[model samples]
Target chain A: MIDHMSALFTLGNMQFLLRGAGMTLLLTMIGCTAGLFGGFLLAYARGSKGTLTAPLRWGATAFVEIFRRIPFLVTLFLVLYTAQMIVPRAPLFWVAVVSICLLCSAYMAEIVRSGMESVPAPQIEAAEVMNFSRWRITWMIVLPQAWKVILPSAVSYMVMFVKDTALASQAGVFELMFAGKALANRGLDPFLVFATVLFAYFVISWPLARFGRWLEAQLARRTHEGDRR
Target chain B: MAHLDISGLEVRYGTVPVLSGIDLAVERGELVGLVGPSGSGKSTLLRALVGLVPPAAGRVVLEGKDVDYASKASLRGLRDHAAIVFQQYNLFQNMSVLDNITVTPVKVRGRPKAEAEAEARALLARVGLAGKERAYPDQLSGGQQQRVAIARALALKPALILLDEVTAALDPELVRDVLDVIKDLAGEGITMLLVSHEMGFIREAAHRVVMMDAGRVVEVGPPSQIFDAPTEERTRAFMSKIIRH
Candidate 1:
């Protein structure tokens, strides 16, 4: 029988996997921050009215549709391969991180658009009549209410983002899944290495999943109380 | 010159004309009541005067300045002169009553925060909502919400205020409270153009009554002449139906 702890800890293999886990966490943080910011711009462009913003709205819609239809792995490979042709010596880590952020942004754009749609028309009209500039109305009145509607779903998307970082290994980045595979290839027990990787992922994802549920419960309670009044 | 003058005003939703060749004027400190059946364009006329509904063809001249709807600066200046309270009492659900009353003055007009708050408190008291300053809109009854909406409009200190079926959304018991507040405003000599189905209140409060039918002004006269001695056939028919109902 294979000794699981010995296989995981021997020859600094555990330390290598821990570094990979750290890289995964780092990628998620950077990707989510950039993705969420880009997604907000996309949401505004996609949902804006009038003939002036038509081209921007159309471009945002096309981007979302194209990215959402393509599989994440294919998108990652295409972005990386195209990028390598332009900057042959560019770091694979940045290429993978940028690709992941772009992919996550397309998904988040739809989430944000739906949240914006959930705000009532009269509320926006009220702001307009009060002589608020368009941006002030959107930033202060619309987004505050939209954020409440999107908070739980946005947290869940972050959890999905954490798992998606494993795809960075396909681009030759040394993330958690890549580390486990490399250790197992050295004739170490595959089960022990993969189990450790799984545990590491759960450590990161479990809290996010719980937090999403907690937010949903809190929102539901507030809505219920609002209805009672 | 009239305080508010609308000449050759027109509004359309695509191919359907809502208001056509409408001309009306309100003098300073006069209360003009607009009485019409549903879809007669009374509400659209009020909305157009405030630049809410862009006029298809017309001029709204307020205090000798012809409103230029295409220009943002012109619209801003127009908003300072006029405000509209809708049938739904569109209060900001996210703000407290005090914030709702003070936000435009503090944010748009650059009024001092403490001064705006003090005025808001006084307006609340005038509207009979003295102690409900911190309450959210949902926490108030429909009547109280409408009163708060009136106070919010009053906070802007506009030269003219428009009321478009402001009591239409309230309960029967709640309607009286809102109308009472409007009565108090009429007593203050504020220039008002009120579109209402409350015939009795209109006759009681309005100095002149404007009758509209199918997007056209059919008659304009004192309440006694419009209600008791309407000369136009359409006005007589409209008034008789309303009185019977």
Candidate 2:
């Protein structure tokens, strides 16, 4: 066991593992950043009132709910086939990216939505009587206050997406897990390969979790201390 | 003609009536004090005026113009001329004191930011919160926040100001600070409808007091008459209960 583990820690193996880790990091970065923006749009569309936005509300609601219920692995294949059908020759990486975006946006929208709704009704009423347009009220009063609630959850979600992107490996998108599997198929000990994969995941996710906690602390202080600007 | 008149104002949440047929009027620059037991719809009345509650039925004539609640333009026109100060002083938590007072004026009213900000500072001074513009709402005491809210309402230059228990949420020691600001505004000849539980403050500041019970006005008279010599049994009974506390 010692000889096998010792052989697994090669410079070439480390480089290969790092490359796979880089792909996982890329998916998380693209998914979280793009998903955050898409999530807000979804949340806003869902939360909008008035008869005219009724259809938009329904469409956004259905998208968040339906996409959230489907498993990530299933979505990877679903998007894999669907994207291939649409573009006929779309790259697997782009197809994987689309699946991660869809999965992350649905979950992130709910995080953002609950944050938006967390504002007391009276706060919105205060704006209403001030003659603020609903859009202005949302942007100025609601969103600024909502960031405190949204940030911690959003960062944690990014950490979660780090692991979630491993699901992309099933579709041959090349990430940490896929590298581990390939190394194992090449006759390396499976335990050692997966152990490296798990360590790489921890390296990527630990900082994000710590950052989330730090952000939560800052928000609490800002809220209580009334930090200027 | 009165500067503001609300006749047959009706508000309901589905089948439950919050305010039914509330008829009241205030002369130009007159302060009308609204006193009532809990759940008597005093706040609801204030909410309805600014188009928050959407009165189920009513004719609200303001400054000789009729307000049609069903018409967006009309409701907007009404809000353009009226503002409300809440008991909890619901200042936008994210904004500095100056921004809270100036946001509507600068953004919604399309006034120049510098001009509106200057006016906000002046209003803040009038409310006795000078040199606190950079502070956020959580930094202020209840009385200070409520005064900030009053300043925010005053920034609108509204023809009518509805103060719904503006001091109700204040610490007892802080109540006098907000009351002092309100008394000064009343002296400036601004029309106001004030809902409060502080009978002593209302009696001293209000031009006339209107007592509400069960979503209806039970009595209307000067403070002396309402507090010392109420005619209706309901007003007398409610006042006795409130004053004892």
lDDT of 2 by residue, A94-118 (tens): 9988998898889989999999998
Span of 10 residues, lowest total lDDT, candidate 1 chain A? A220-229
Question: Candidate 1, DockQ to 2 decimals?
Answer: 0.38
Candidate 2's displacement at residue A17, Å, is 1.7
Q: Model 1 misses residue A47 by how many Å?
A: 4.9
Q: Name the top DockQ candidate.
A: 2
Best by TM-score: 2
Clashes of each: 0, 0
lDDT of model 1, residue B216: 90
Worst 10 residues of 2 chain A by lDDT: A220-229
Evaluating just chain A, the predictions reach TM-scores of 0.90, 0.95
Tell how far residue A69 is off in model 1, in angstroms: 3.6
Please give the lDDT score for candidate 1: 0.87
